[model samples]
Target chain A: MSGRSHAASRLVVAAPYLWLLLFFLAPFAIVLRMALSDADTALPPYAPHFEGFATLREFLGKLDLENFRLLADDALYWDSYLQSLRLAGLTTLIALAIGYPLAYAMAAAPRHWRPVLLVLVVLPFWTSFLIRVYAWIGILRPDGLLDIVLGGLGLTDEPLRLLNTEAAVLIGMVYSYLPFMVLPLYAMLEKLDRSLLEAAADLGATPVTAFLTVTLPLSLPGILAGAALVFIPSVGEFVIPDLLGGPDTVMIGKVLWNEFFSNRDWPLASAVAIVLLVVLVLPLALLQRARQGREAQP
Target chain B: MRKASPGSLRRAFQPWNDPAAKPLIEFRHVTKRFGGVTAVAEVSLSLYPREFFALLGPSGCGKTTLMRMLAGFETPDAGQILLGGTDITEMPPHLRPVNMMFQSYALFPHLSVADNIAYGLKRERLPRAEIAQRVAEMLALVKLDGLGKRRPDQLSGGQRQRVALARALAKRPKLLLLDEPMAALDRKLREATQFELMDLQSELGTTFMVVTHDQDEAMTMADRMAVMDHGRLVQIGPPDVIYEAPVNAYVASFVGDINVLEGHVVAVEGDLVRVETGITGMVELDEEAPALAIGASVLVGLRPEKLDLSHDEPPQPFNKVAGEIWDIGYLGDVTMVQVMVGGEGGWLVKVALTNRRRRAARPFAWEDKVWLSWDVEAGLVLKP
Candidate 1:
């Protein structure tokens, strides 16, 4: 019985690891192999395909650094990388600015009302993500709902030129990723012991002072988690910018998509994806390390 | 209002007795209501300087609400609260000269022990050097000197409790509120921390107001305690007086284990009253009941330990009841014998006998008939 139970437990532990290995790790290894190969006009779009052990050795031997060098030589790749980082950072900040207050309100609401608020937050997610992004197009386009409303209210004399702009992309991203930020933040803020605030006030700290010293510092973990949830996905976002943004909004994800489908440079696209992964992984690994260090201390 | 009470003479720190001694904190006709429930209703009380006062009650008895009002966490719907004779009714919590050691400790998880203690001092915007100095002093005071650099998670429950105490006290507020200070500690540690808290309170001379439901803790540490029930103060006195001379049946029953026998007053002569009970027959009680008339219904309250249990019958008639032993509970230090007397609906009196000897002189067994008796002074005549 013990042996059977031990095997069952081991299987439960191995399930997620096995799934990641089969799907994520295997795909990444294929991408790495494709990134090292030279571009071709043939089917599969890359040279020296792996057929067997000997052919694999030959493919590995013939791998070139030309694709990576080409990426470095092109200024567009660098600009796209920088733009992606900047936009992702801005989206994270915007989400945090809006989500913190919303989460705080939800947490502070009466206990019975919290579930309704949480449902409202997650209600938008029931619809398809693509459909939501598409809905933003109609709302943000020139002479769209915003323009009509503003004109009807006499707030604007002329039609607002809001369509296909960086602002539109930002609106879409923040809207799409808000629940990601709010859920984690709400979870943290809700679990916070209210007596701590009372203790702070009793210690002669004003409300604002208490928030700065106690609430903000204690909610750091939630803030970091929320930021990561928005930041990581926004960095690699393709659908929102593709639908809402103009030509000037050249994000790395857009660049990768164009390279694979329009430019047909499969090796170059793989190289860009590898570099993007490295860029995103570095900060995330650092965050995990810092969290571990904090846990280790106490 | 001051009275020359005899219990005040036993304590040197009886500021309430001195007519000139002003109270450090006062609640005048304070009333707070939560929705349909009145948590605290028109409560007026005073706490003298350097006194360790405890608000003792069961859960939802408004003891906590009273303490919260004093801490400025809850505003009273009516009446006023005064600190050092100044009206602070409208003042916010941060402006109040008070600090509270939370029941959960509420130690800032991100801060080290020293930093947690320095939190209030920093709010005062004291010099950097002065803040450090005070932090060190507080750490030393709580005997957490070297552990200042360690975060709250690194400390044990007892240690965390001390850190909370040190942090609350570091600001040197005139009044400190401790909400069930020892509720989180284990049985052995709780007793030790109680004495430690008492010593610390005396050493600093800071007036501390503690809220607790534990009768033993309140009795052990408080200079004086107020018993509360249904959002009203039932009795206010020293532990000795509250235990021995509780004003009503609620205060008497709530404080300790007491055997209340239903009876009616048969005769009354000055301080002496004779009560006729079904189980114990006619029992003489010494109680000052001026309004009690002949044939007035009353309850005769007797502590379990006060009853003397014996196998042999007495020479003369007394306040005694003979019954067959129904149950025996050996609690190492004492043996609790529950005796069932009379027929149906009989009185089941619990008689606690100390196991002081190595061998029992007369060991009691189940179903054995035993006589339980007490002196006339031991029985308290309480108004039913």
Candidate 2:
């Protein structure tokens, strides 16, 4: 019985690992191989397709870092990377600024009303994401709903030119990723021991001081998790920027798309994708390591 | 175990007896209600400086509510709370010069022990060297000297309790309120911590008001205690007085184990009263009798430890009854035997006998016919 149960547990553990190997690792290996090869005019658009094990050594020898080197040498790729990082960082900060108070209010609401608030946070997910992004266009375009409302309210004399701007892109991203930020924060703040706040007050810290010293520090794990959820996705976001941002708003995702489809530079696009993964994964891995080290302390 | 004799210390510092002594904290006609239920209703109390006071009651007895009002967590609806002659009824909790050791300890999980202790001091914006010195002193005071760098989760429960105590005390408030301070500790640790807390309170000379449900804990640590029931202060006195002379039936049973016998006053002789009980026949109490006509209904309260049990008939004639042993409970320190007197459908009276000798043979068994007796001073004549 024990041996059978052990085998069953092992199978349960292996399922996710197996899934990752087949779906993620296999595709990543193919991309890495394509990234190392040379661009060509052939149907596949990349040279040195795997010919068999007999020429394996030759295939390995043909692989090079030329695409990566070209990416580093060009200013457009560098600028796109920096702009992507900047936008993603700004999105995270704005989302946090909006999400923290929203989550805190929900957590402090009456117990029976909490479920309704949580449902409201997650309600937007029921709608199609693409449809929501399209809806933003109608609201943000000049002479659209926003401008009409502002003009009708006597707040503005002329139509607002907000569509296809970086501001529109920011508004779209913050609206889409808000739930991702709020849920974790709400979960953290809701379960916080209220006695700790009382203890703080008992110890002579005002409510604001208590929030800064006790609540904020304790909610850090939730903050980090929420930031990662918003940052990692917004860094490579293709839809919001493509739909709402102006031509001057150059992000790496748009650049990667242009390189792969318009220019048909398969190796360069693969290299760009690889470099983006490394940039995002490195910090995340470092953060996980630091968290684990702190948890392991006596 | 060296017992800290708070009894002697309390006798030497009985400020409540002195008419001229001013109370450090006072609550006057404080009334708090939640929705339809009155959690604390028209309650008034006082605590003198350096007095280790306890509010003892069962859950929902308003003991915690009273403490919370003093700690500035709850505002009284219609009353005044004065601290050192200043009315602080509407003062915010942070502005109040009172701190609380929470029932859950409420230690900050993210902070090191030293930082947790220094939190209130930092709020005062003390000098850096003074903060460190005070933190070190608190650490030593709680006997957590070398564990200052450890996080709260890393410490044991007892250690966490000490950290809470230290953190609350670091502010040196005029009054430190403890809400079931030792409720989280194990029984063994709880007993030891009670004495330690008493010692610490005396050494620091800070007035402490603890709220708890455990009678033993309150009796062991409190210089004086108040028993609360259903949002009202039922009785207030030292532990001995509360135990020996409870004003009513609820206070008597709530404080300790007492076998109540239904009886009536048969005669009143100057300072002595003779009562006739169904269970123990005629009993005489050698105490000042309350105003009573002959045959007025009364309750005779007999503490278990005050009664003696034996196989043979007791030498005394009055206040003795013959009964069959209904049950025997052998606790390590004492043997509690329930004697069913007055034959069938009669009252079962508990008699506690201390085991002074190791491995003493069982003197009483179940179904054994035994005689129970007590001195005249042992029976309390309580009005029914």
Candidate 3:
């Protein structure tokens, strides 16, 4: 019976591995192969077509870094990459600044009200993502609902120029990802031992000092997880920028979309996609290594 | 049960004995209510300097609430809290000069043991060298010197507990509150840690207040303990005094294994009160009896160990009860025998006998007739 159960458990573990191997790894391999090929006006749009084993070997040997070299030579790609990093960083910071206190409040709420508050935080997810982004356009456009509300409140004399701006993109991104930032933070803060705060206060630490030394350091895992969740996706986000940003906002996601569909340069788009993945994965790997290093210590 | 330790025998340390001596901490009719339930009713208490005091009670008895009030975690709805004769009821927890060792230890998991001990000192903005020296001293005091670099999870339970103590003491506060400190330890480690905590308190000369439900822990470690029930203090005295003379039935039963027989006062002669009990026939008590009227209902309490049990009947002129053994439990060093007295509405009296010899045969068996006797002074008179 034990041996049979062991084999059953092994099969259960292998199911997800096989699924990922077929779907995720296979697609990534295809993209990598496309990234190495040359752009063309043919039906597939790229590559010396794979023929027999001899042609495949010859094609692999002849693959060059010309696409990456072209990307480096062009100022548009560089500007778009820098712009994407800046916006992603700003969006992460704003999300953290707004989400930390909100998550803390949710965790510190009366025990009976916690579930209700958590559901409200995640309530935005039930609606379609595109509809939510579109809903913001109605609020942000000049002489729209926001302008009327501001005029009635007498906070502004004139209708504000709010639509199709970088600020609007940032606001959309931060709002879209706020729940992702809060859930992890709420989980961490909720599980925090309240006595530690009392113990800190029992020491000479003030409330602010206690938060800095005890609460803040202990909740860092949640903060890092939340930031990464918001940062990596926002780096390559296409919808919010395309719908809310002005012409001046040249994010790499839009650049990659224009390269693939408008310019029909699949190889250049694949190279850009590869660079973006590398950019996101490097810091995440560093974070995992740092966590492991701390765990490895006595 | 035993003689007072030499360290507690000093007169200067015994502030409760002197009428003019001021208390270190005072709670004046403090009351706290949590929504509809009163977690702590109007209660007044005081603690003297360098005294290892204990608040003993079962769960939901307000013992923990009283300690939390002192720690400033909960504020009293009405009344003032005085520390060293200054009202501090309005002071926030961070401003108070008292530290607590939480029941869960609450050691910061993200920090090493050395860093945990240094947490409080760093708040004081002390010099770096002084902080390091103090941390090192605390590590040595807790006998966890070489294990300073380890996290709290990496250490054993006892070591983690000691680290919590060391961290709480690192600030050298005037009063250190311990909330069920031994609830996390096993029996053997608890007993050893209790003595170590006592020795440390005596050496540091810091006033310590411990809250616990274990009667043995209160009796063994506390210089004096306050027995609480329903948010009110029933009795407060040294362990010996409390054990020998409990003020009421609740204190008697809560403190240890006891047999309370309901009776009425039949006769009162000066300091002696003779009570008629259906279970034990007639018993006499040597407590002050002027306040007790004739034929008034009262409770007669007897400690299990105070009663003598034997197969042979006792001589005449002794307060004795004849019964048959219903059950026997052998607990390594001592054997507990439960005897049934009086026919239908009988009394079950528990008697403990020390097992002096390992190979000695059992003296009494189940359903065997036995006689139990005790002195007049052993019976504690209480109000019904």
Model 2 segments more than 4 A misplaced? B3-11, B315-317
Better of 2 and 3 by lDDT: 2
Give the CA lDDT, 0 to 100, for residue A64 in model 2. 99
Give the local distance difference test score of model 3. 0.90
lDDT of each: 0.90, 0.92, 0.90
- Fnat scores for every prediction: 0.87, 0.84, 0.96
Candidate 3 Cα deviation (angstroms), residue B4? 14
Interface DockQ of candidate 2: 0.81
lDDT of 1: 0.90
C-alpha lDDT (0 to 100) for residue B118 of candidate 2: 97
Pairs of residues clashing in candidate 2: none
lDDT of 3 by residue, A1-298 (tens): 6999999999999999999999989999888788888999999998777788867778888677888888899999999999999999999999999999999999899999999999999999999999999999999899888999999999999988788999999999999999999999999999999989988888877888989988899899999999999999999999999998999998999999999999999989999999999999998999899999978876
Which lDDT tens digits does candidate 2 get at residues B143-193?
A: 999999999988999999999999999989889999999888999999889
For candidate 2, the lDDT comes to 0.92
Pairs of residues at least 3 apart in sequence or in different chains that clash in candidate 3: none
- In candidate 2 chain B, where is summed lDDT lowest over 10 consecutive residues? B3-12
